[model samples]
Target chain A: MILQLIDIGYLVAVVLFILGIKLMSHPESARKGNSIALAGMILAIVVSFFTPGLNNIALILTAIALGTVGGLYSAKTVQMTAMPQLVSFFNGMGGAAAALIGLVEYGDLPVDDIGKGSVLMASLVIGSVSFSGSLVAMGKLQGVIKDIRVNKILAFLVLGLAIALAVYVLLSGQPKPLLVYGLVALALIYGLLFVYPIGGADMPVVISLLNSLTGVTAATTGLLYDNKVMLMGGILVGSAGLLLTLLMAKAMNRSVSNILFTSFGTAAGPAGSGQDGD
Target chain B: MDAIINYISVNQQEFYIFILAVFVGIEVISKVPTVLHTPLMSGSNALSGVVIVGSIIVLGKTDPANYLALTLGFLAVLLATLNVVGGFAVTNRMLEMFKKKPGKK
Candidate 1:
């Protein structure tokens, strides 16, 4: 009966998420949408406490408290001009959480469960990439890291290495902790290199893509555990991210891949033309 | 191959739900005007905080002996918390400014 209640809670949360996104498309209802989504999140978290197998109540509460304070402080203090960087930073955090969960879960799985292993590897790879890549995006936006020229040959080489590592791990047929870690490391490096070349003009698109990647990672994690709420939340975020990325790209009159690969800021138009003046 | 197929078949309902979500997600955000893109991005960034749910689940289920899991779980909670709280607060700030603009008519 309790399980049934939790399921109902998840169902309501998913409905609210959909409604929230639907309402957010226009300025008139955006604020209400956010509130609705916030309520959904609170409901999901509260309902999760009732699930079977959860323990360490005090630690969980402490983590939530610390996170709440940190999130609230930064949100309240950050300037509007730095919104992009702040968004990237928060998105990176979400990615980091998903990647870490994938890493922690890797040790417990049985060998030969290729299905589960594949999902775990995907979450690990995508999450690590998003985490590292979003940090690079933040760095670029903050001007802390400059001269991010893309070396195509080098970028391709790193991409090659990442792919090779993923293939090697897949073929090995068992979860070797060393190779898993190596795959994660390589993906992180690839992410850094991937975002280094993309200019600031493309940040919105890049941020959206990273957001989607984080969502995909979360969804994969949800799949590993068969958690309905997590799965639904992840899917919603993923699709929303993709949609936003496309919309932002369209707003700038650029293709998604073009924005990603070409350093438009350095090569052509006046600085800040692509971005809105707030 | 058979294992993968069996997995999908077992989770058919979940996949169906995922497909339905994709449609709704794409459909809902189609009407957001360009001027609000930044605010929309920030708002959805806050929504990504939904990952906190996954982090909590992982931390709660992790064995106490596994220090690595414990540490990672703690960090995940910290980071996701930052994302959720910061993302929303910043979005609200931006939206307040947005409301004052003449464009709202």
Candidate 2:
């Protein structure tokens, strides 16, 4: 059957994704890895069209066309120094997609399945946070947003509120429209506040964290739909993002928590001081 | 609570796969030097654009009357597409700089 074939395609894609990541670790093979990953992505997309219940081909094509043009233009022109910001922007987009998928699928779920609802809620929260957080990160890197020093207490408080909202939404059982919107709004604000205090010097770590968030979001969506490829892709990206974040932190000799909670590159302290001249 | 437990049990295989991937992901990128970190980051950014598949699926399943889903799905696809295209393009541009010229020593 076509379904079996599609699943097989996804399996192949997953293998290629893993291989691509493995190859990308070295400078010598990184480009080849990228091409392999690209081919896998193309294969996945092509196979998804054959999935049962898929429709609205025109709209899909148009959206993809527009995105391709914009992505190509920006990627071709972005400066090396600004590459981090560009990555942030791309990560934000991925987060947005994950969140939007959750939103679209929200209405179709059964009302009694609290388990599924909770999973969806988690995806929405993480996806929204990553999306907005990456935007702020992009702004900071571009010097469009000032690195205003926020009190450490305020940042923690906001983060606490976001977590609380997530818990409330998950436990509420039924999808109250108001609660969903409120959770999304609070998450967005939390994301902004989360990255606001962190200085620009720590952007690589921040981007990595957000990337992991997107991966988590995607994986949750896969769980909701029981889609193997989505789940595999999400898990792969999530793990990769986590590894990258840790590696970047290690290279800088800073812990993940420190990078998240402490403000660097502020007028109060010079950058790279924590490294102890490593 | 029971429902949550059941759900987790149902997807036990997924959790196992997730754990395995985590270890592999960490090990694979362990030896990358600091100089290549940015490109690695950018390259992974493009990979994250895999979310486009989810968006396409969502949009494809929804009815046209569901304008909200349609609009959001469209935006999601567009944004994810941009991520993939731009991320890959920029990553390639960065890598190109490291390549030696044909006549260079």
Query: lDDT (CA) for every model shown?
Result: 0.81, 0.81
lDDT of 1 at A187: 83
Per-residue lDDT tens digits for candidate 1, residues A1-278, read 99999889988987887787777778888878878877887888888888789976788889889988888887778787888898899999988888888887888777577787778888888888999999989998888876477777787787678677766676677778887788889889888988987876677789889988887787888888887777777877888889889888877777787777666445555665434433
Candidate 2 chain B worst ten-residue window by lDDT: B96-105
Native-to-model Cα distance after best TM-score fit, residue A138 in candidate 2, in Å:
1.1
- Local accuracy of candidate 1 as per-residue lDDT tens digits, B1-105: 787788788889878877887777678888888877777777777777777887888888888878888888888777877877777778788878877885673
Worst 10 residues of 1 chain A by lDDT: A269-278
Worst 10 residues of 2 chain A by lDDT: A269-278
C-alpha lDDT (0 to 100) for residue A12 of candidate 2 = 90
Distance from true location, Cα of A91 in model 1, Å: 0.3
**Per-residue lDDT for A221 in model 1?**
83
